[model samples]
Target: MQKLNLSQSLSQKLSPQQIQFIKLLQVPTAELDTRIEEELEINPALEEGKEEETEQSQDDDFEDSYDDDLGRDDHELNLDDYLDDEYSGYKMQGDGNYNSDDDDREIPISSQTSLHEQLITQLNFLKLDDRQKIIGQQLIGSIENDGYIRRDLEAIINDLAFSQNIETDIDELEEILRKIQTFDPAGIAARTLQECLIIQLERKEHPDDPVVKHALLIVQDCFEEFTKKHYSKIQKRLDLDEEGIKDAVNLITRLNPKPGGASDGLVRTQYIIPDFILTNNGGKLEVSLNSKNAPELRISRSYADMFDAYDKSDKKDKKLKDTVTFVKQKLDAAKWFIDAIKQRQNTLLRTMEAILNYQKEFFIDGDETNLRPMILKDIAERIDMDISTVSRVANSKSIQTEFGVYPLKYFFSEGIATDSGEDVSNREVKSVLQGMVDAEDKKRPLSDDKLVKMLNKLGYNIARRTVAKYREQLQIPVARLRKEL
Candidate 1:
């Protein structure tokens, strides 16, 4: 067991700049500003602006700016690499330094107050003693982003006693929670999805509306059955005929399952900034990366001047050289960052262009069926890059098309060969599966077995389990749950 063995194993490791380039490549348009700001804060030499020199003059100055030996030990460089146009350059845009027509600053903050803030505001109207108010505040705090207090009453009681030095029982906490539940957005302090739905239904209680009363009954008495969409069981249990049950079921379907999210289209949070934009001009497709992705960065002139002063100084004291070294190090870091950004832009453009060319038909017609079978390796081969490199670009990157915004992953689908000896995209199969479900008779919704037959008829030749997998991927519920009156 203690025997020594000599072995040689070759492993490739990414350099620091290469790693940086990969990270920067994957960052979406939304977070690019934050990343650039972080670099600016850390590297004094790096600043946000285009270089001031004219192209020809800058080329001439670049020669005399620094000799071969100058800054060689410091190592890193950028400006010349940027001008190299490394990765096949861009096609849709004039330069890889692409800019956006729309300003990100135009996006507005949420007009409606957040869920917890809204809950806290409602607590002001309640007439409570100090102890009661404190408990009420804790309960409100316990409420999650979805407006549900998922924590058990026992847990809250323990938390109050041990942490807040407030001796509170389960009963008192429940009273406060009940009061909080009565607040706006209808389902604020519910414990579960069932409870949230019941709260919304009870709030909309109407004496004359028979469907409303039946809906409440369905939620309270047959929650499990209602959730499974076992409409037949609910009808038999409640002794309701076809028409009556259908009306009641339809009303239940209309209830807000997620009351905390989009209450009558009055609340919203989060916005997605697309990384690229694709447009169809008659038949030709134009693709460009987001403007924020390509920032105009240049080394600070003042920092460069300081370095130059140090470089030419006759004072060769240890302290002077040390200061020069520090200046050179910072300058090198800034140059490295700038170079990484340029390479990131080049890689992104190359990757997007390859994907655009591969999925050209889909982008042109805005048709999912037109999307060919494409994978990371397929793109890697086309662009002559590593599969992992292509993957990094497609991972979080999104493109805005004339049709809509779509993630790069959306265009890359696995191949599924048909009985006719033709390979098609898995998306094509999913589309057929979705269409079948969408057009199925709700009274007797098609089961996975039935779906398999339909898909087989369409020349897919997929198994039932495969159909189930695709259905789950699409987030569509099973036959029993999908059943409707």
Candidate 2:
């Protein structure tokens, strides 16, 4: 038998305290308030309330007594000693006053119905038998928010048989699904774009109208070519003129691609809480984190009181000893959390300051042209921190400027060297490309090669493939697809 070494080298990892700090740093301002509430709930020693006048007087007296013996050096105070010090230095001064009166305000919970829920609610009014109702409910549930049934029919049939204990054939199911598709929102349960349009056209009161009927035929038979904007082939097949093709294309364009998205009385607006706020004060750009999102968070005073009580109690008593140990553990945890939050704020401010300094011109003028090439390494080098740390700061953070709020990642772009031997942001090049495309004649669209030449003439020195990649990134199609009649 071979002799084996049993020992293994295990590297020390970050303590729970350090990990908590890193997590806090990653949380943006919008979610900071919720984290504070969570901390308050976990630590009973932590309480949220203003200190009474008598307590404040006692604190002042204690601080005065300590200051007389310790002299004027405040830096010697540790984390615990600092909290015991009169809450003077930490108090928000002048314009930094936080409104404590609205602490009791209740956040309302709205039971807003989703699109599918609304559709299901209407399904109840229809007169259908028990089995048909069950099938309709299943079909309604299958309809996605975009009004498409992307699920495979065979799988659905299997689900109904095994899960719901109901035997259903594809022919019968398809019939009911067609009826569900004809519900209030025209194309509710279509599996494809072609099916969606056909469902709507079939339900039309004037089904024989030349334009409507021709558009339905075009969608059913030549959908692949039609979507590619191959109007000449369609015109040749139908033997129609340019005006007739235009009428059919216009009719198809008017149909709602996402039928479920147009539900009335149900409006959903996304809330955008910015992490950083940038304003111009006397021609100087002033940057500050949105303090409203990050409420004033500190260790609960109740926890401090419990700690004090434990310290004063007799050490010989077993009950007191156990209580002291419990209180110490909780107090240590609370202290670690408070320190982590402070460190997070410091890191965030430092990282954002470096970013603002690097892109001062872009921030001053809300123009994409003013943006320069910047990467995580650039900011990390500027701030003398690790690239990974800088990346964490940028990942989820958002900045609000006079123009609009944008994620921190929006400012960074890879650089491309121009003919003048100067490096420019790829974002700037993309903007230039988009502008050129917007100005180009749709009847005779500019090809990728022509765009590359134009960009080179303008000193960008980009290859044809690079131009094509940029164009595709912007979702602009090829010249053939972009062509018009």
Top TM-score hit: 2
Please, what are the lDDT tens digits per residue for candidate 2 over residues 300-369? 4433444444434455867656655665676667667766876787788888889999989888888998
RMSD of 2: 7.0
* Each candidate's clash count: 0, 3
The whole-model lDDT of each prediction reads 0.77, 0.76
Q: Candidate 2 overall Cα lDDT vs. reference?
A: 0.76
Give candidates' CA RMSD values in order: 8.0, 7.0
Model 1 Cα lDDT, one tens digit per residue, 85-126: 332322224432334542334765556766767777889889
lDDT of 2 at 329: 73
